[model samples]
Target: MWSNLPFDLLANIFSFLSPDSLACAKSSCRHWHQCARCLATPESPRRHPPWFVALPNRSRGLFCCAYNPIDDSSSSSWYMLPLDFLPIPTRPVSATAGLILLRSTSTTPFQLAICNPFTRQFRHLPTLNVTRINPAVGVIELDPGHQFGELNFRAYVAGGMSEAPGGGALDEPKVEMYDSRCDTWKVIGSMPVEFAVRLTVWTPSESVYSNGILYWMTSARAYSVMGFEIATNSWRELSVPVADRLEFAALVQRNGKLTLLGGKCGGDACIWELGEGDVWRMIEKVPFELGMRFLGGKGCWDGTKCVGNNGIVCLYKDLGSGMLVWREVADEGRWEWFWIDGCCSIRGQQPQNFQIKGLLLHPNLAHSSLLNA
Candidate 1:
């Protein structure tokens, strides 16, 4: 009878399972697989809140150390998810929804793959049409189609320089796009040369995808955001607030809205919601004591990390400092901030050993066709 349970009841039961347990259930029987797959549409509610995953490159096999903000400093819990199943040395290029986009380090021109580490389901995408380093990577995961009912997404590499025709300098600025449904890449178009140079040289691969637009913060002196609209294959830029005064800045999609987080040198950290007409309005700011503590002894937010989605945003300052987690409650129109313990589980020989990347992801239990092997 348990196996023959009604579809509604079974889906309710499936919703209670954690991601790992859900994976086991999907593999246990054909009936369960069918049951689980039916419940995996984009409309399904996620089981857990967003978690901060501090991904550090490791040689003795890959392990994911994640921090759940709700656990509080007293518990200081960290979840370790092994990534040994993946066959290559790869860097996480971008993360959206339940999928992580990875770039392989083993190949001449880096290879790209999108995977759900929780389910151990992975798929490698075709080689990119553009060859460049450190380009702005973006991803947009859409709701399943009415016909196929399969979840789909797009992975984009924008504003990267290409080797010159004469093979002189890495000068051509172009955008490459990959569609998960087709598993292919296309050279979308060339980027404005100014943005391409900035992107190819050093923009953070972490990006914000919202409303079919992908956003990346530039490293230029006047810090502007490079945005790409997938539908039109068009490029645009948004200038950040107090660009010169701020020592730290990042773009985040908070609760389906565009947000800006930054702190000035020897000043308070701010959270701004991007308003219509390309304006920014303040939503919150760090409490003075908290901002000072987060800035560490250097007394500035230099090299800080701001990442989140779906109403949760996290801020991290280096030098072994803990993270500041912010949450917005929609029904109440309220917001709160708190501090959680840092990633102490990741061990290394000082800071010289590895590249540590961070992203805020809501751990999902349901099946994603995009990640299904």
Candidate 2:
């Protein structure tokens, strides 16, 4: 079989197959295994951008939907992924950067599973004992030198359980970082500020890493917002000028500036931008009628765009429906709406089914002009 087909051609065919298909192909025979393994190896030249978003489902558990911003016109392809192959918790938290990190259950010991869907390669991360009983997990890409071939990945687990039983209200947050290059974890230092004792199940208020800084909002038991810097390992109390009170706030980067978005404590949705000297300024108030809601709006900020769904309401409108609206602040800060359908939505009936666990964007299918040759 090896002599029959060109190895390069065979590798390209295997690259298009999902992880599950690759496994089956590997078992067919020795030749197939060699071909499959070569194609699945991390060093393979057929590596493609990880454009799939992992979503949780009640029936299928954790599944992934393919997303490609280049092919905005193509419908998204949803594929059910195998949870058994991965060491995922019952209530796992997932983050994507070529590889996906799945955090274990809250009650269980601290555990995580790092997976790369393209290569079907997975590594189970060891749990570290924490000072606090509950800790927050985050993933960030640091500047891995040119030797690693750009985008070296790492995971960080911050603010774990307090060591002392029945500790005071404020427990010092601890930080640990995992470097893929070294394939090990290290306790770096303690968080700059004290974290809330009660861990919120939702995503981190903000985990945007930019210019070597990871920014997130932490609330005390009193619900007061405190901002922290990961690079400098410092903490500070940030005053949100637009709202005296907020139910939840997320720190986002827009057009290269740090921004914040949240609903007022009284329930008015709003967006805020960080101005010079770290001053907070209100940019726009999202109208409730726009049908926008946020469950964990932390990852909503995708550079120039943000998307989230708390229930049926979505922050970004569908391009085909003529209802999806966006305000351009860098240009003129004017509101504009466009209609596009087929945008992913929370699947469920009314009332109890309104909760949206995930949001997905379709990929574009345009062929590269240079590839025509």
Candidate 3:
């Protein structure tokens, strides 16, 4: 009976399906696959905002949950990621264009794997030659037309302790990259002498890719943002204002602009946009009332985070307070907040590894079988 329906009606019905459900529907039959392709087409109007995926807490196996508040408000409604094809004891360091960069837990030489959680497909890259405890990781998906199913992307891993197997600390900062097209890894660049001196105690964090540059925040003598131009393979550094205060700040991209989230001296969280000449201009602050909701009208916030997808920005108070997602009401000058009750309740059993972070991925009908390992 379903097969007798018109193609338009079938496409319309499938439009409402979530990423996982849509993947399953595509495999149900030939007609359904055709309908799924319509939604996956580059010009389809059924594109949905990326879902926020959180890493599992303590379980031995690698587990993840996808939270799409727009489709379901309840935390329990989030879907589990199909990571059966990926490596175990692995942690995701970066996510971009529907792909995740995962590193195995093996000691010394760390192997890398890139996977698309939505499609349940993954490709293993060669192991990184580093002996550092933590390294900054980043990825750039070169899908100009937003064709997510196509596995065309590059991954970068940089900066870690150069301690060799014999326990001698080399402390040499290195950068290596993997290109999916070439299926090979190459040494792109190394840390500048002047920059390495200041990075004696570097903190391994995830790098943010915006435009063609990848930015990583380093915590050493002072806070600094290190940038690497993927196309040119050049490097530069920008000092973060009053680095101590923004110690745990998160770097995120908003509509192609670089934004930083940090707490004020008084403890209120504020959002700043990167401006020309290495200057940062304050754009938004957590209203007093909103801060009071999380602060209990007493002390300052512990710390806050900002994550964005498309134009939507999610201000998260990692200290148990619920998330506040907002977007400029198209053409309206004011921003609006999306309240997802019980959103913060779903914490990972174990926190993500030091170098791994959560990612916001847009919904797509791309499947894993189509991509090569």
What does candidate 2's lDDT look like per residue over 182-228, in tens digits?
66678877654334342333224235554455654554433334444
Our tally of clashes for model 1 stands at 1
Per-residue CA lDDT of candidate 3, range 1-373, in tens?
2543445446756766899999999999998899878753444442345567665322234556667644553555455554566546677666665666677665456577767766667666766655454566777777645445656778877665566668776555677888876777788778775554444346444667787888877766666788888778778887775577653566877768777776655666777788887689888877767666655676455544556754677665432345666676656557775654433344344323321145676544456443554
Best by lDDT: 1
| Pairs with backbone N, CA or C atoms under 3 Å apart (clashes), candidate 1 | 255-311
Deviating ranges (above 4 Å) for candidate 1: 1-42, 57-60, 69-76, 144-151, 318-320, 345-355, 364-373
TM-scores of the models, in the order given: 0.79, 0.59, 0.76
lDDT of 1: 0.70
lDDT by residue (219-314, candidate 1, tens digit) is: 687778888887887788898888899888988887788889988888888888887887889988888876766666567788787777767888
Question: What's each prediction's clash count?
Answer: 1, 22, 5
**lDDT value, candidate 3, whole model:** 0.63
In terms of TM-score, how similar is model 3 to the real structure? 0.76
Which 10 consecutive positions of candidate 3 have the poorest summed lDDT? 347-356
Winner by TM-score between candidate 3 and candidate 1:
1
Name the lDDT of candidate 2.
0.46
Please list the Cα RMSD from the true structure of every candidate, rounded to 1 decimal place: 6.2, 10.8, 6.1
How far residue 30's Cα lies from its native spot in candidate 2, in Å, is 35
Model 3 stretches with alpha carbons more than 4 Å out: 1-39, 43-46, 57-59, 72-77, 82-86, 129-133, 163-167, 193-201, 295-298, 317-321, 330-334, 343-356, 369-372
